[model samples]
Target: MQFDRKDKNNAVLLDLYTQLLYPRMVEEKMLILLRQGRIGKWFSGIGQEAIAIGSTLAMEENEYILPMHRNLGVFTARNIPLKRLMAQWQGKLNGFTKGRDRSFHFGTQDYKIIGMISHLGPQMAVADGIALADLISGQEKATLVYTGDGATSEGDFHEAINVAAVWNLPVIFLIENNGYGLSTPTAEQYKCQNLVDRAVGYGIEGVQIDGNNVLEVYDTIAAIAAKIRKDPKPVLVECLTFRMRGHEEASGTKYVPQELMDAWAEKDPVANFEHFLLTENVLNQELIAEIKADFKAGIEYEIEAAFQEEEPIANTIAELEDMYAPFNFKPNALSPDAPSTEVRYLDAITDALKIGMYKHDNLVLMGQDIAEYGGAFKITEGFTTLFGKARVRNTPICESAIVGAALGLSINGYKSVVEMQFADFVTCGFNQIVNNLAKTHYRWGEKADVVIRMPTGAGTGAGPFHSQSNEAWFTKTPGLKIVYPAFPQDAKGLLLAAIDDPNPVLFFEHKYLYRSLTGQVPQGEYQLEIGKANVLKEGRQLCIITYGLGVHWALAYMDEHPELSINLVDLRSLQPWDKNAVSNAVKQTGRVLILHEDTLSTGFGAELAAWIGEHCFSDLDAPVMRCASSDTAIPMNKVLEEDFLAKSRLAATIEKLLAY
Candidate 1:
């Protein structure tokens, strides 16, 4: 099997050729499989194989690369087993995501490859997080993330690059300018001369390379990577390439002009690289045939093995169990009998964050103006001085970037708590929260151990923009834990527990209760169970189920009406709300009323009422009712806001239920 090439360059050339040829052969085989219905889909990287092969091979083993769906060569160059990759493509149990995701949608930490989600630009931000983790740990590692000419137009692309540039994190923003984005040509995508030209706006170096030339890609990327490691900074490298095939097998390239296709065909990466190697005598006709034959046989064998592999079976319990990592709620540093101090809900949260920082060194706090300015609510006041800027990081006003970065940090052995200055502002980063962070665990078994602190609820007359009880939006999304605490003790305990949980937990802190609610809180570290509901008052006449500000309103209503005995349940966690406690309370009281600050229609209260009606039907003396804010935006006027909230209607709703 030995080749009679004496030149040292021969070995390097052969390695590059083999790496380049493997993915090409694999893609060709996969395309055939797709036509035969053996595989579901194929995103051919036939012409652009050189870019992936060269750039990936140029990086050090410890460094990370986030590849898009088109970069099949990145996986092969990293030497990931062909069989497992085939299994993944075939949706088999042996795959990286265990058939949960297809193709490059899954990331493998073992190989230092962070996979891309469907939203292409978010991975760029994720790369920033990885590089930030390395920088924080004093490692000279760099991250390389890929995007297309089309994805460059996405807001995340700008946010990611701008943040990376500002922080001087070592990152390579590789744009594969493949001319077309699902049939939309580059002419329609942007007005810029080249994708790399946009890099100047972010204050970063920009370079354009002929992506068809593997040697150019390798040399350019290798040099940039070395320079980045020595002096950390972000660089934008645009690989001028073309997609030789349709976006996917199903999408035909009828819109592509015949002449354009013909022109690009002449610049075939695999054929050109082979011709170069042959001209240099590093490879001959016989050697090329042997290499292609070997790759084809290996790919065929793996494909056959992947076909034999079992499809992932749907097990309800196991699937549910896989949604989150095992959460171990730690015992309190102070015993239950220990002396407690009264503090505002805001101070309790601050204390918990401080304790969390002391406990978990890798815990990072990220938000706008959270460091020096002490945040909008001043929850992290003096945090930068106390914990240093590294841990208590003040991020730019880029929610999507920070949220995606938090997921990236979670990927690399760090727990992050992202604070939305206001809960309403979370809509800006909704995709990162619901799609990326929430689905990461279920899709790839990569737990996003991030806590998003949402200062939620209305009553401050902050208007529609600042005041919103938006917990109901995320309760519908699976794989996310939503924790809304009503009191100071619960706020501290639930937040600490959320920080410890190995999943993305949305911790809702009511802006109204932050300073108003004062209660006896344990002085030291303590974490309450996340999904458990606490009963504030025990009664049998009627039951009220609520969380956050609703708990306060219900408590006050019960205090005003002493004759109406009520069982008040504070559902601390919405996603895994205490169903058993709610059902038991309903059965005990024989009447149940669901309440929340969110709008009435399709709110979390509606869900609770439906569950109570379905499960506790026989025990109910009256129909399960709900009291929530009117279906309208929170108004700025204090009187209108009061009227809009469920608090004004709570007594009437409760009395009506009791009377029934």
Candidate 2:
């Protein structure tokens, strides 16, 4: 029934009367379930049901809504099946969380709505990201993030809000200011009594509405959404309501005074809305009884189904367990077939990037000196010419911001290539890369298709921060691909592969080899690939595993020491490196030597050596070995720089292998 604009009383009666009743009934069932041990805990949306329903009803179906644990009404209204939801609450196999995610923390890939999360702040940032994507991709759908007033104190909340405001993201932040954050009230927590007022600092519109009045809440939200969908700015709506129940089903009762509870209970939203409905004749007592009965039966059906569902199998739940992909640093494999066309490794990389950028409009490039300077090494000198300034652009020295913004951009339907001036500088943006970009897809099942190009490994006299070999640091980060290219042709192929990947990829281009390494690469649109190994040579006596510039050195070593038969493998992709190829070569030949330019303490070489030793234990005549730099910072001294690198130590390690 429409809340006829003509009758003021009819508005509350028809629109919010049932909304209020449904939430109260749901809460009652939630309490019963808690008593029966069918649910672990419950967050009551009790006194503010009208506001919850009103704000939620304002959104389009395709538009995204991310709610906290207290939003059962929103999830149920959105059609998230009650049985699956109850199963999740019961920690059963058929739970909406697929028996993997925590009860009350649910996510659905099919529906746009994100599942509830115990972790408060991340959802705010994630909601903004979804809106950013919609804005960039030209998608009509918007997004809303629902959080309590207390959550505003979080750094992630501020960070997300600031960025969203600055970028004019199509998002709405709905704050349920239900009097307190558990034991503490909003006044004690924040200096500003109004949460909406906080938006003034971020340069966006902020509004406060009466939570008990469903029509007011709905109209306010609808107006804001309309303005936001047109202008696409972040808005904060502070709902003035009260929480009738304790923070949890059985907790917070000790802290909350009964007198205060009585005060809050007197203005009970369900009764207020029901009275309004009756006053306007939108509904009578008989209809109210039937509505309660229908909701009662629905809740009963859901509870029964939760009990009837079968236990989840181990393996199916295991898929949810593996959101964090394992990292195997160096795979046993040969280098990619020498570039078919004669070209430098940097040249192949440039070709691959340019081709991919042109082929897919979503690909974009950003770095400190990339635009006018065309990058420090000038690899991207003409990238802007081909891809245009919008696609190929430069950024400030804010490494953290660059990586964070790129992550924000990726969710918006763009594949970003974020270039750190040097591999050593990745430390600056380490948090954003690992915590945000790397784990986004893992936690939320959201894709972050972006490439981080860090010019790595020490060889030149660049020294210390500029010349550290930090591939192992990134390889340790799960859900991120690490690719190290040695030759020009392989550079083009692997880069092509990284751009096409849906996962975040860390492309560690060797600073020393950018210009020095040369090979054949097709000038046009071909790509090599990521996740495969290149066999530089096949031998019977021993197998040598190397990557990046080490591949060049290994090839040169083989050429000089032909009397010793050693198969060489250049692993192009470090994260998902070719384990099969490496193990196969180790199986073929009993001897294996892992080599890298990084330090020996915890380098990729050590990982490779361990894997080779494990899988090929009986196949080997001798123990596995690694030839890498000592555990020390890259020296500033030109002469000592070369000495400190794996290059100087490599010869001796090779001799040790031959002697054995």
Candidate 3:
């Protein structure tokens, strides 16, 4: 193809032939900022500008794109305000996140870019979902997702690509093959020689380009994207790029070979491009000089603006900000307005999901057996038929993928609801939930709207692994919402409320309650605000705090011991706990007891008791006591298992509290 020197875009391209020196210089300046205490850590895209700009040129501006830490080229090319990027580097509020979202993992709604996932390699599914959503909506936008070659090792990369290819979604997966991952070279890290080749397994188009050649990268991607628009299928574009900077701040080039660095730097992208353009007679000296001056001035303005920008204060998240969109407050969920409608517990669970899905379009449901099988307990019976397969999806048997997909999907305009076939299997996604979902919100103020439902709380004789309640693990996560429904009405209402809430929620349903539990439900759709504990029976002698199926056992024990006075309180939610209600009951009763089906020692019950003792010690007549399962993994024997749970021993504990 002949070069069009007269074209403005091509004229600018001539300047960019080795023009990334400006971007490279900016990367060095960022390092200076780190030493001076002006900024925190950084991931530089110094030598990899061609990959970013080249791959980006072929992308539709409206298409969804997920970026990684060292993706300044993607952000810069996409016009995601350069000054704001500087602000983000400085950990200031004016950046895209406004000090709320994580510095690296964020995007502007207006920009149409998505993600910077906490986990290294899960955003692929999010891009796929975006493409899937666009396809369904009849909008012809593609989803262009970028990841390091190192990320290909993640299971999500496989799961997402396989699904995307099979479904024929318009998504372009860009692999920035930057030779090394931190310290490990690709040759040593991956079993395969080329990443693009792996796309064959998924039946997707795979292409490789010289990542150093800017023009080649651009033209090739543009052609591929055009084909994607026509064919509307998945394609893998591998850009063989190289990293010149250290992985993070203060890291050394000690692991990187000096000879290779000197060699690659000699063929520096900026220098190579400039030489290429000059040799082609596409650019003259004066135009190139002017572009450099202009670029320098523009970046200086960004740096200055970033330093002048302000950071957010504490009151913003606690008081000033809207929970969801710009104007409306995310539904201020309501507890059942009155007594239960006298509905079955399973029906309440169904009603809860329905309410949330009805009130919020972003709320979506997905799980195995949920779509065609209607759930193992039929809790989601008819849901797929009502919501359609798009919203209520039946996923393959991959729990890690299921939860990980939910976490990624939440990055877009989605509030994902995921179901664990059994609560015990939640172990499969423990890392995503604990390391990513749990900390993402508090650490970055990023919104991870997810509802994970697990049938928990024992008594079904389904054996230890399937029957154990694991509320403590969720409660340990700082930013998650943990809600356990005790009654039919509360179950439905709280679950709906959790769906509408901005944080991730773990709604642990007691297996025994599926058919056995019953209560009056609200007439219309309703919500139960998270964190409020409901006192089922009021008494001055003692306080019993329990949730899930334990609430029933607590009530039964109260009825049996007519001579003993105890207030049975059902803690519907764990995180953002209702400290006021707990304190009031503790003060009134004099003696308090905390109870839950999760094993003792550092469990939710223990935390509750510890908090009560710490905060309400002066008002209490006796030291707070906790009734929980023995501190051991649930065993297989049914009778011994019954003996292991606090519910089985609640009567004696309540009597002990009553005696106090």
Q: Judging by TM-score against the true structure, name the best candidate.
A: 1
lDDT of 3 by residue, 1-660 (tens): 133333446556754553455666677777787788877777777778877777776688877677777877777677777788887766687766566555567765577666566667667776766676565456776778888888888887887787678668788888998878888888876887799999888888899987777777778777777877777898998988788887775775688888988877865666777776777776678977887678778877889888998977767556333332221225444454543467788888888787766777666688877987888888788887778777787777666656666765676567788999899998877767776676555544457677899888677677768988888877876666788888887887777777776677888888888888777777666666787789888888888888887777787877777887778788888876888888889888889988888888888887888888899989888778888888777766888788888877777776676667
Worst 10 residues of 3 by lDDT: 320-329
Taking the tens digit of each residue's C-alpha lDDT, what string does model 1 give over 411-515?
A: 988999999999999998999999999988888888899999999989999999999999989999989999999999999998988998989999999998988
lDDT of every model, 2 decimals: 0.90, 0.76, 0.75
Task: Score residue 55 of candidate 1 by CA lDDT.
Answer: 98
The parts of candidate 3 lying over 4 Å away from their true place are 1-9, 12-22, 31-40, 98-103, 229-231, 311-342, 355-363, 407-411, 434-446
lDDT score, candidate 1:
0.90
lDDT of 1 at 125: 94
TM-score of every model versus the real structure? 0.98, 0.83, 0.90
Tens digits of per-residue lDDT, candidate 2, 486-565, equal 77767776777677777789998898887777766655555556778989899988888988878878888778887977
Model 1: colliding residue pairs: none
How well does candidate 2 match the true structure, expressed as C-alpha RMSD?
Answer: 5.0
Task: List candidate 1 segments past 4 Å from native.
Answer: 1-8, 333-336
**Judged by lDDT relative to the true structure, which candidate is superior, 1 or 3?**
1
